[model samples]
Target: MSGLPAYSLPCQSERATLVSALLLLLSWLATPALAQDLGTNGPTYAIAEPHLLRDLQHRLQAKQASGELDTLMARSRERAIASVRDPQPIEGVAATRTPRTFYYDPTFTLDRNVLDAQGQLLFAAGTRLNPLDVVSLSSHLLFFDGRDSRQRDQARRLIAHYEGRVKPILVAGAYLDLMQAWRRPVYFDQHGRLTRQFGVTQVPALVSQDGARLRIDELETTQ
Candidate 1:
């Protein structure tokens, strides 16, 4: 219910579009000679701490060794407030198998068939989901509106926090009724019996209920 954070640039701008552009320029200006000294990725720099250019420059200086940037910092965490870790080589660890569970959002992507053989994804648009099959993960979700300074800061922290534990899936959704307002097509339509059965009425709803407790759910805001 609170306002989403305002992004510093136009909403049309990429999440790190500005930074990417800068990197491209820097890469060009310091190519070949510096690039070799810096490694294949070059001496990387990332916004850090305060999430601003100045802060990033400060961190870069502190992190740089002489005229050479730190190898680790330059490659993975460069210019990113967060550091991306290389996957640890598993020594003798064996993979374990688990039962496949369905994770779905009508507004999001689902693998293979989101619908069952019965042709129901959840319920017909007008129908309400049964209480048994859904688990609300909204409390665990974060939103980035890019309007509020606080949310912008939070977004940075959130991105860093989930750096590699889970890959982030970015998609846009709208209230089912306002699907047309989206710049692109909505992911799914709840017009069938299944959608009706779930009684879905909102856009951007994420339902992760179990078989016994299906229901429409909204993500809790993490601003």
Candidate 2:
């Protein structure tokens, strides 16, 4: 009260209330703008401008012309071919079989008889022959991955050694053109039936009959 001037309490209170309302309104309006800037809805992306697209196309053309992609493909093919050729062999595995023995009367009446052109009885019906006298037909079935060059060469050499008596079974390759070009009778595994039957785990394998069972040899190929 000595030399200072003071506002009324009502006036002061009104000014403070007005300032608080202005701050709240400003904050509410700024919330949405800040959210948009921070990309809360999702990232705001700019499309590649015309010049940028042209630049990318030009770079792609340059790479193709430099044969970089071709070189990579060739290397990939070579690695795949090498992997097929040099397969690891499993040890101490042999073809398994179930043995069954049955006996029947040696004498039986024939339901019908078969005769040859010369009126000779070729086989009489119900004629039982001795099992010991039966001969089992056996052959060599060579398994190979025909995609690899080394395996194919090894197969060719083996076929020549066996005088083409080896039956070529392709386990994991489909090169019909190459088969035709090489003039080889190549057969497919057809859902891996032969591989399972002979217990073959590797490529360039040789399956042959050994007495009553089969012997599987997984061959290693050189470069």
Per-candidate count of clashing residue pairs (backbone under 3 Å): 49, 0
Task: Give lDDT tens digits, candidate 2, residues 26-92.
Answer: 4434566433354347666887567854554564455457865445446656877765543332333
Clash-forming residue pairs, model 2: none
Q: How close is candidate 2 to the true structure, as a TM-score?
A: 0.40
- Following a full C-alpha superposition, what root-mean-square deviation does model 2 have from the true structure? 27.9
Instruction: Give the least accurate 10-residue stretch of model 2, judged by summed lDDT.
Output: 94-103
Count clashing pairs, candidate 1: 49
lDDT of each: 0.37, 0.61
Model 1, CA-based lDDT: 0.37
For each candidate in turn, the TM-score is 0.18, 0.40
Question: 101-120, model 1: which lDDT tens digit per residue?
Answer: 23433342333434668887
TM-score of 1: 0.18
Candidate 1 regions exceeding 4 Å error are: 1-139, 162-223
